[model samples]
Target: MVAAIASVASVAARRIRGGEGVATRGRVLLTLDPGALSHLARGRDVVLVTGTNGKTTTAHLLAAALGTLGPVAHNASGANMSDGAVAALATRRHAPRAVLEVDELHLARVADAVSPAVVVLLNLTRDQLDRGSEVAAVATSIRKSLRRHPRTLVVANRDDPVVVATVEGMPRVTWVAASAGWSGDASLCLRCGRQLVAKHEWSCPCGLSQPQADWELDGAAVRGAGVTTPLHLRLPGRFNLGNALAAMAAAHALGVPPGAAADAMADLESVAHRYATVRHGSHELHLLLAKNPAGWAETLPLLKDYPALLLVINAREADGRDTSWLWDVPFEQLPPRPTVASGDRAADVGLRLSYAAVGHQTVDDPLAGLELLPPGEVVAVANYTAFADLWRRLAVMSGR
Candidate 1:
């Protein structure tokens, strides 16, 4: 009774107020009945994907893979807190399985409630500077949570030393060497507190090192469990490949075949405009979203390949108030080209580019900057709120 009312209200609120209403719904349900999520999670197979990045993409892929077996409920709207999980489960009550993307900090609490069948631990990096904890602190919290849920099968990244160290010596674990690219956060050992040496694999002087993998992403193929299955994904970047591998490992732990999971994820082209292309006027804008330094490190190199690049930045509440992380980004590495900075914090990005010796202009509006570009390809890399604004604008322009 409470669940139905809360879901209906949330939908109405979303329609009237705009934006995803999972948060509102979750709040209402919890206010009315605190045990709503626990009640909905009963007698269901659940998979939880949590990390600093790739949580949304990995969860989407895992849900799609699981959808092959039956109707699976998931939070596709990117609302990842306890309330979001509650709202999704409450609304889709009949679905026998659920795959949820949980916030890194909220994972332990959410996992405590739902007790997921499998947990996918992707790479962690510094993000949400104003509000988020340090990488090691977040990992420690997750480690403690996983320790509580002993029966939950953990599918963790073997390539990430922090992730590997978290689940070290834990039973019922499947490791995936997904080739996580960002090494900035894991330069030191989490357990041993020593400098990590990286050659073929990352290891610490205190004996904490990268673990052997049950699943390995080998170029275009995923090899594990005595079979190599090729991934044909439309999503760009090695990070997406790593995400797919993490999803595959989670799916495998939950009884889905790796080949089938790979096949299912191949059709996923975009996840909340992480790598979406939009046509605005004469310019074809390729959209890429990056939040923190690690994300920019992966995204910036991709922007270099484009004919023109647009870097949008925002320092909104959701985007983290601290714009200081901008210095941590390797903007100096970006090739000299036609570039523009626009967003709420366009001036900040413009100043950063100046320090890096990269030539760029600033525009109050990103669409205004788009008018300056030639009628070919333009790659736009934006943070959370910036990407959402651009995505929403393009959606309105296309009348969708």
Candidate 2:
């Protein structure tokens, strides 16, 4: 009854705000109360997408790819949980379908509420150990959620041993494997309890000869669909290609036209702080988001090649203050050590670099490093919390 009341109240609030009648208000109502999800899709379909690391980016891209079919609702601002899901449905009025990028920990909770017509599981990696169960625990939670609702279309990443191994007994799954350099195998076989060996180049079982998608991302271009459009991806690195593939494959699973997939990629966008470029008094800082070992490891090559000053911020627990992950991250790979470190945990950042024997300076905020940095080129790597802190400080410093 409480859920129903929230639905009704949300609709009424939308109407009071001059919303677009029941259609728009209805989406809002359904969000506040997920029984409305069933009601809204009574005769329609919904798509639910989830993953660690790239959920927001991949979810939005898939939604945009399928948007050509009709109006598509998604968490454009990356509010990808139950509350954010409620917030997303609250505002939108019309869409043929909703493509939601949901949180890994909250996937089951929100999935039960929204009960998406299709469920997408991207690669599961380590992140937010405080707010979430360990990756293995969260993967089990996802399996349990799927068991409750059997009709949802399942898209599973085959390259991730932990993610793929969870759903082995289940036959109703579309398998997706990325043949790129991201090859990760953190978990072993559920049935054999043995670490499966990769064949066909560290991809399949026990080095057995098998067929797999040979995915080589040329810039933003993906092979294997005879689909080669001009690569217009805003983000760099090979990891993004997998995110792009997840979007493309998930869009295909939704029955969206193939052309729309490429078109959406052509018109892609980015959320704030995911490689967002900021200009402060003739200085350009590409705010790159690096939160975990995988993400941090991926950044090393990019940072090494980038011809600019390195600025990093690691403040909150979310940034993994232990910073021991840096040991595995190969910090010495970058040619020059970071020039400045700032945040509540700036010392932690400096210590990690120092341990790796990377050089650095300490500052109170991003712009403080600016006083010592040359104004021509610079890069700022901020974790989840530090990003916001740095953003506000930069905003004030820039008078924006």
User: Which candidate number maximizes TM-score?
Assistant: 1
Query: Could you tell me the TM-score of candidate 2?
Result: 0.81
How does each model score on lDDT?
Answer: 0.86, 0.64
* Segments in model 1 whose C-alpha atoms lie over 4 Å from true places: 6-8, 11-19
Worst 10 residues of 2 by lDDT: 15-24
> On residues 64-127, what C-alpha lDDT tens digit does candidate 2 reach at each position?
7887778876666665656556545544535667877777777887777767778877776776
Candidate 1: pairs in clash = none
Query: All candidates' TM-scores?
Result: 0.96, 0.81
lDDT of 1 by residue, 1-400 (tens): 7557666657655653223566787877777788778888989999999988888899999988998888888988888898889888877888999998999889988998999999999888899867758888898999999999899999998888889888887788998887777788888899988889999878888988778888887879999878999998998888888889889888887788988998999999888677788888898899888999888877876776788988889999888998999999988898988899899899999999999999988996998987877688999999988988888888889888
